[model samples]
Target: MGSLGSRIQGSSRGAEEASEGSCAGTGHGCDCRKRKRSSPCQCDSEAEEEDSLLNTPRRKKLKSTSKYIYQTLFLNGENSDIQICALGQEWNLHKVYLCQSGYFSSMFSGSWKESSMTTIELEIPDQNIDTEALQVAFGSLYRDDVLIKPSRVISILAAACMLQLDGLIQQCGETMKETISVKTVCSYYSSAGMYGLDSVTKKCLEWLLNNLMTHQNVELMKELGVAVMEQLVQSSDLFVMQVEMDVYTALKKWMFLQLCPSWNGPIKQLLNDADSWICKRRTELGEEEAFLSTEQGAPFTPVFRQVRLQYIINDLASARILERDNILPHDWLSAVYKLQWFAMLRTEHDNDTGPQEANKEEFDLNSMRCGRKLAKDGDYCWRWTGFNFGFDLLVTYTNRFIVFKRNTLSQPCGGSVSLQPRRHIAYRLRLASFDSSGKLVCSRSTGYQLLTLEKDQEYVVMNLDSRLLAFPLYVCCNFLYTSPASGRRADAPEPESSAHSVS
Candidate 1:
């Protein structure tokens, strides 16, 4: 039994690795998947180890001579014992392969009525379970290991679930994880959700969130159902390429695609009762093709509700985004600004002057402490970056979107410090950590030059590799301008693990 298990394992891997050879002989090019490999050698190296060679030339010759598709003989039925049918196709499967799965073991064992039957008909009539995938599964039981490919993963998953094939399920999950990318994300997410695979679903969601900026296709966004969209938007841990405004625009584009099919393909007569007030107004201004589309728009409101509109500082861009074809109600942004004002006022009163209508710009860090002073290590600096516990900031591998939520951090410095550059150089900051071998590694940014420390400002890190540093790192920023004679190392606190995996 042990040697058989090892041989089956080796064969499964060998079959997957020999993709070109596998297709050359039998199977692959699933009608249910992306179809034929661009190159069979295009398979990833993560698949499996090489099979051990037979000890003697005699054994090798025998193995090669016997390399017939013996399973096909069962389908051909010289004297087949069992008839298994699925999706209008019949397979003459041997009991050994079929019995390996719990779903089949229960059925074919003496305890079940199927023990008395030779014909087994699967009830998965709703899904197109690829016969090719089933062939691989059964073939593994005989002489090959399971061959899992990303293109055929969804079909394989559906078939495996119904067959209760645990090995196929695991291989599908691992392959999905290894192969996830911009193009396959949506399809993979759908498949993972359909099969109730939580681990794969989590990886998909995280990858999607961190890489959302890569895929901005309206059709792709539309394909993502409301539940998935909401899940992406609702997470604070979502790593985006820009501010929430980019996220907002992406969401609006999706809603537009859903509400206005004409946005993509071609214009059509708008339903008279559709958001007609907005449409008729658009028509009067020679903007007949432009207006708010409310079709299926209700489900998307929660996504916009989660957008931090107040955090988007570019008033003009925000206005243009909100006014594009009048797709969103004009009053929506009005209400948003009002809420921003209300929240700011409430927080301001709670923090200091006890609730008075002050201009939003009045709260700028520049207004506090006259704002143009150098960031010194004295009482003026709020430790480093003026953030408490550093929860309001994160840096990614690209350093293109280093999110430092100014307002989200505790205001230890009370108001903004000088973020603009002095001459040509920008304000700089550094974070450091002891490596696994106890060496200090540092990540610094000089990109804050010519920038204002506004509550809703966006900043990018200038360094590439520095941002990819490990977690449990510490932040350090101090100026030791004491008279050179005052010889003493600047006292610094240890960095807490932010776990900001830079890569």
Candidate 2:
């Protein structure tokens, strides 16, 4: 009986040992084999087995919801509920998606005839809209986003405007503003005006104001219409090089191009060709009258009239050009000459120390525009040549700082200089640099402001960062030396030059 009991005890011990070994291997106190089939096992072998189940060949991801809808409903026209025809093209569309457009929404929601019709024919009166533009516009209703090429943005904008797609219209405006260049500025300006895109129009004007002189282009000059040219020339913001005379010269070249559109010549030869053309015309007509008074040149008179004749006649060389060109009416030159004579008398006799107040209107109409170009970074000191009503302003660039010096006795200057203790002048200064494509890379401006300067005193107009300083930098300025006289100095003596003295 003792041997049997010992054997039973040994058997019991073996069974318990085997159970412990199984539990240790499974990492669970309970037997994994006895657990439900769906239960988790904490063994490494089970983890490996589960990992094997997950391993499979890679596959392309499913397209997004918006993309799938655009392809099936827009591209394939599958199960389309509506058809839109415009610009001789048809688009299979759905009412639910088309409702996103205000035009279609109104048609579907209102009692319009299109609401009951399965196919609607749209009347696109806008010439800018085309078949491709219609396709993109219709597809945009179904897609999350649309890709607009800069070249095609105007067309899309027209389509969007007709369909009352405000979102797409805004996008097109932003694109036009971003892509404004010499190539696109004129067209964009015209289109913006036609489409009521005031922001885009203003942007184009600002670009032209900055680049018209700084980055002169022959093609661009040819594209400018008379109205646009007049607007630019009359604006005080026009970037003029050297003096107001240069503005007149630029206009002359532009007018020549406008008349002779087929004359595709390099810019360097443009001026001579223009002069010869005018001379030949004058000879052919056998008319000694001013060119602006003639029928052929009459169209350009408005643009030419914007030239500040007072400033042009101040310089002897510029005056000579004015007489030689015979472009202005004799009455125009006479009036300006008489006006300048009285102003000069005030400067010489009346102790008229420059303008004290801003006088924005006077400044805008008569300010002297001048500029310089720096091909490379270096010290530059110069003065624009002309009698500035005794306000001899000297401009200098050094150490990336632009300094304006009111010259009284520091330098030997040909023009007269003001001697008043404190002479006040209204002026604006602009600086800019461009990249290879004539894109403005860096720019700075000091809007019109009144500045007081003493004799030999210098003021820092601008302090530029070295990093932002670019070669071929352009500096433009507008200066109003004296206020508009309330009335001609009552007893002012006549100047040596007569009213008819221009010739």
Candidate 3:
């Protein structure tokens, strides 16, 4: 009834020793074997035969002993020698298993009075340690596989870190990484940072930058530290697919959430006085320095500095930001707008292959290299402000090309590229930019195929051919109905929609 060897033996030997507990030693009983007689009923041989059976193999003995130790430590908790108090509950643990930990080893190994006591009480005086986490952590020292729930994972990680259980710490880290997501990553990051879980921290930080803390998922951005938020703004690698203002808008919302609880005034008024709002900090910043203090804009100044005002923020967003008075002042806003204009120019110059001589005759996109200046339909904001000049050029197949001065807007910092609604249905489009003197600047087209427009659907097309489209830019989409599927003439142009200049 012990191991595989004990359960299955010589059939005749099993039958002989099957009478509750009998003797079977080398086919000869111990006493009779010494007397050179085959007597089966020698009662003294039971102890010798049992010892021979149980202690034959070193590995089996070790495995058996290990199992016994585990059972004695965990299964027989009532007989435990130590009472560990955690989270208002006392746990029974064996002194041997407890000694395996440096924390408990230091307590029980010394000549301390508690070491020799019959009922030693153990406690870790950490207010933040989770009791449930401690229980699970202790259970792991006995059982190889322990279930760490998401709700308790952070707590368990903190406890394991405090106890200096390296293996359990590693397991808890893997559990955290496995469960890392938008919903749980913030807590995981907090716990990892709090407990110095470096591997988990690195992974979670990567996740925060790549997938979680973005315009599409702004909620996670609130969980970020000011340092991390600043790093995000400073990083050229940080990619948010939406317009830059969406990113700013998210910060605005987070700012509001920090202040709305205390003030009894209008939200507009609060936004106007955002620097005056006070908020609480989640954790200690470190020695002597408070996490949050009573000061104007102390909580949010770090946030505002990293807003990347150089990105294209549209008129609406600019107005909203100016109205809030939390982020930018009038003079600063105007300066930022000018700065953004120069930044866009620099980006455009960098993106250009070469300042090619103004060529209106060369219209083939494939013949030229991929860049904003060459590729058709590439991401270029329709700079209505600077796009006041351009003339229409007539093309083939009953079609015409309305090439605006400057084929497309330079790199965008803000706003959607939606044309003002007017009375017109577009059939075909060829959006391009030309210089002030009616010279072609850059061009993007649907490439030989006329595209129909749909309402509210972002018909964004990036040429695998045009690599410059990788950067986020607004492409001008005109309204037109062309039904080639209905056998209607694709070139039949509808009424053109009236639009004003917007960038």
Candidate 4:
């Protein structure tokens, strides 16, 4: 019985050792020994199959979570709520909840729910960003209350245009058009022509051209004038024609009435042809004349003449004189003689008075009596006749001849007076000076007239010369002096000469 018990105990220990060895190899007790000896350990296969099944589904779920986190955190943050509307029905409630809750929190440490709620409080829905808003914005900007810069304004305008805000777009367009100068507008048009803003550029061009035309800045227009003309011509041939017609009408009316020159047949034909061309172009473009003047036979009042003259004077002053020493005869005459002649003619036409009494006065070479005495100190009183178109001949003691015109004469009466040649003369006279004691030491006519000599005051002749003939004078004074007899002065001083001459 002791021998049998020992065998049983050793067999039990052997079984335990085998079990430990099998467990070390397969991590499970070997079942092949209990079953058929041909069967291998099937437990390893079963364990591997179970692990594959479990890990496959878990790996897929993990990948899906990663994708959700990437889209929610990286992609969704870049898009606004309005953009998200494009996702369609694929954006289910479960997906949204997962994205806003789990994936958003995991990736960004925040949820869309909180962000949406915060943004909703600040945003106003259905706010019309039209003219009213633009007006308010512009008013604030104009008053310098707004801090937005020009570049930012452009950006806002682009956004407004893209969003189909018509009033805001138009307002911005107009503002941009008005604020940009012609030079800058041209530059921008050339360089930034491909920015999908051709309409804005066109508006800017139109505004600049319109303002230039209205202001009539001819010199400025001439400087950049060709470009504007080209633009207008290209826009609508009719527009060019209409502008030409208006210009022709204005020029024709001015030539006939204000300029004192009749419109010749050739000039009329040229103007008519210009008008017809303009009309034809306009008709093709279905456009009407913009500048419609009411008066046809009205006089031309050159409001811009002063401005034009100033520009011309400045230009002339700055330019180099081609022939300084000896000026051309025509140039000198144009500058001096022609203007004097015109002034003389204008005076004659304006005055309605008769010629001065020629044979009335007593002439003393030493003591001359004027038809109307302007000044008399003791024995000699300087006298002058009224201004006249015809020349008055005065003979003195020496070989001196004085030619006076009607325009140079002064009316003894006080009122508005015109410098008619019949009343005045373009003459330079020499006046003789006397001592305070009324002693005439010598007789002469100074090249310059003494301004202190009153209309009726008399001064002893000091000097005289023929060089005075070279000087040209325009009679501009309207003051008239009379003798004590109320008769017009015959020998009034010649009209003062200006330092500069105009044509």
Q: Residue by residue across 303-392, what tens digits does model 3's lDDT show?
A: 666655544343455555444433444455677666444433322322211112322222221011111122333323332222111111
Ranking by TM-score: 2, 1, 3, 4
Cα displacement (angstroms), candidate 3, residue 353, comes to: 8.4
Model 3, which residues run further than 4 Å from truth? 1-72, 78-81, 86-88, 108-118, 212-228, 261-298, 313-326, 334-503
Per-model TM-score versus the true fold: 0.52, 0.83, 0.48, 0.19
In terms of TM-score, the best-performing candidate is: 2
Model 2 collision count: 0
lDDT, each prediction: 0.50, 0.84, 0.48, 0.33
How would you encode candidate 1's per-residue C-alpha lDDT over 1-503 as one tens digit per residue?
A: 57998999999988776653443332434232234555333223222222223332342344542245454554444456778887677877767667887778888876777787899887675364778877666555555456677788888887777778888788888888877766677788888888888888888886665445433454565577777788877654344333455566566556655655555432132222233534455566553233333444456666666664545522456556456545555566677566445433322232211112222222221111101111222222122222111122322322323333234334446343222111011133344443332233444434223233343344554443534655544332211100111122212211334111110
Q: Where is model 2 poorest over a 10-residue stretch in terms of lDDT?
A: 494-503
- Candidate 1 colliding pairs: 11-145, 12-145, 349-355, 365-416, 421-450, 468-502, 471-499, 472-497, 474-495
Residue 189, candidate 1: Cα error in Å is: 1.0
Q: Give per-residue lDDT, candidate 2, residue 384.
A: 93
Write one digit per residue (lDDT tens) for candidate 2, span 172-214.
8999998999999999999999888999999999889888987
lDDT of residue 335 for candidate 4: 51
lDDT of 4 at 193: 44
Q: In model 2, which runs have C-alpha deviations exceeding 4 angstroms? A: 1-62, 410-415, 487-503
